[model samples]
Target: MSVSNTTDFTNPSTFILLGIPGLETAHVWLSIPFCTMYIIAILGNITILFIVKRERSLHEPMYYFLCMLAITDVVLSTSTLPKTLSIFWFNSRGINFNACLTQMFFIHCFLAVESGIFVAMAFDRYVAICNPLRHSTILTSHVVASIGLAVLLRGCILLLPHPFLARQLPYCRTNVIPLLYCEFIAVVKLSCGDIRISSYYGLFVSLLKNCLDLFFITMSYTQILRAIFRLPTKDARLKTFGTCTSHLCVILVFYIPALFSALAQRFGQNIPFHFHILFANMCLLVPPTLNPIIYGVKTKPIRDRMLWLFTHKRT
Candidate 1:
């Protein structure tokens, strides 16, 4: 933890990223699982995109949002994992300041966008289940496109200030980020300037985005559930609810680890550093890796398409 006197105080050119604070000795071993997850995430998401695109029957609002989620997952995972593996494997930890900010922006921006996509997917389910007669008309192609645009813009606009704010802060302290990637809070904490504004702003934005999205998702699912129970036949209820199972699983996969990681990073001061970092890495990796698998297994259309593709390739 020795601070170098020669380090630039005002504006360092680069910052050193310690992949995981206390797990330095095990970085090589850690890279194995991380690399595997990265490969799976990329291939799975790509397969999802391919299946949805090639299968004309799957061109509905629900799958469109799934495509958006897949794309976001790819970007989100790509923004950090390569750099993380580099840090772990080669000990290549020096990240240029601007590159760090870029990484931070992509990571946070797509994370928020992913949350918004979940809200959109939930709304899609609500319409399909609760208002079956008008589902297609309600979520038309134009409307779906607009929803995707709005979600992307909202994420970009909300997170655009993060890099600027961090840049404005004078880094009179050590230019060392003690995390896997350039996390917003970790980078900002390096500034010697008063960081209350940045900290509060980050907190406010995080809570605002997650809470609003969660509220909308919950409301949509509530209506969906009520609609499901109102169906007279048990078979009808089961069949209808089954359509939502995949989406619900994807939502849980994305949110549970995300929320837990955020809470641990912000509040769990007593949590072990390595544990927190590992959990946070999983929070990012698990969703992308599992999302395609979840949908492929639970959604019959996707499952069938994937099987056909694989079997056809063999033939």
Candidate 2:
């Protein structure tokens, strides 16, 4: 049965977000942890950014990539959390149409940019490990600047259509989105018009950004591993492997939850809706919170700089 296009021609100017259904009673309690995680994510990424910017010794290709990741994390987290916490704490779920579209656009754009950063970082690692002699030559400041521009442009241009597509649709269904934030698919699903185009575009972008990016990252790591194994001494291999441990942890933390949530949404029919919702939220939240810590612990310069900053401030 087709949904009636003429049932309610008057579209709503504002939309409401149904944030974490079945948890209404516990929203206040939920806000506590959500607020804490947001604070930690912002502060952690800021600290990384500040440390990298301040410490001249840390001004290298790796740290520059790390800073890009930090900026994306901060933007991604802030794009969703303020409104998410607002819905939880202040019961402010009403968002105008344009605002919802704007939020969704930035949320997805930063996500794409972040994924691009991961691929760039993977390439950086491959160059540093497999072509040590040419690492500096390959990843000079000009090259890094070019990579940054490419990442930004790829994200902005590719994700540009999503919001415009959503805006063109007639949202005659309920204005209540079923996610914590205004996700592209969720908003598209609310449209009463034919959504085949939007659905296919969403799938195309997902595979393009997520699957292809992950494939290249995995290939990069495979080459890095192959290069490591070719090293003569065990100590050299161990030392080389240690440098990638942080990126590995970050990859696992990011991709696992993201893939899980995506799969669960599509295939897990018996899964609870709340489980899907929370996992989706975690997909956005956990990464930014963990990235800085993983880097700080696994990378020596960042950890030492952080310790030094703390100690130096004591005077």
Winner by lDDT: 1
Tens digits of per-residue lDDT, candidate 1, 1-315, equal 343534667878888887787678999999999999999999999999999999999999999999999999999999989999988888898899999999999999999999999999999999999888999989999999999999999999999999999999999868888788998998999888999999999999989999999999999999999999999999999999999999999999988998888788779999998899899889888999999999999999999999999899999
Candidate 2, TM-score vs. the true structure?
A: 0.96
How does each model score on lDDT?
Answer: 0.92, 0.90
Q: Which ten residues in a row have the lowest lDDT in candidate 2?
A: 1-10
Candidate 2: tens digits of C-alpha lDDT, residues 74-167: 9999999999999898888788889999999999999999999999999999999999899999999899989988999999999999999998
User: How high a TM-score does candidate 1 get?
Assistant: 0.97
Query: How close to the true structure is residue 189 of candidate 2, measured as C-alpha lDDT?
Result: 86
Clashing pairs in model 1, backbone N/Cα/C closer than 3 A: none
Count of clashes, each model: 0, 0
Per-candidate TM-score against the hidden true structure: 0.97, 0.96
